[model samples]
Target: MAEDHRHETHPEIVKRLKRAEGHLRSVVEMIEAGRACLDIAQQLHAVEKAIGQAKKTLIQDHLDHCLDDVVGPLARGQRRAIDEFKEITKYL
Candidate 1:
């Protein structure tokens, strides 16, 4: 497994994830209760958006901490870290 160097955990991210979890539970209930398709779709969309926001927060943290630490002399690990950081935005 890769080591996670982005150590910052914003409270807002935790709150959003908690809300997303509630939304997911509601979605399961909707499925069990045979709710309308559109309503379920809307709830799933909300979960997706929440997850995307969390990912953005994590990427920002990586850039701020891990990437900032690599700005010195060009050691091999530093070069690889810089390359990975530059490419990370594509995943977002």
Candidate 2:
């Protein structure tokens, strides 16, 4: 992934992703250890939420910084492009 220095949230997002990675690993262990399904599901949910938050942060930072830097003043077309990009993030 490309890092944009203008966004201060990059490091925070990385940390969140790392934490999610760890949780996912633990979930694997729980499965191997025959942990209760509910317990494993709960941890998996946490991992999913963490990753989702990281993705949200990344997209928001791109909108807040990258879009602004690339387009000084958004024309109607540019605004439409930006809106489309933001719309795509809704699926994330």
Q: How would you encode candidate 2's per-residue C-alpha lDDT over 19-79 as one tens digit per residue?
A: 9999999999999999999999999999999999998989888887787777778789768
Q: What residue pairs are clashing in model 1?
A: none
Poorest 10 consecutive residues by lDDT, candidate 2: 2-11
Local distance difference test scores for all models: 0.81, 0.88
True-vs-predicted CA distance for residue 66, candidate 2, Å: 0.6
Judged by whole-model lDDT over C-alpha atoms, candidate 1 comes out at 0.81
Best by TM-score: 2
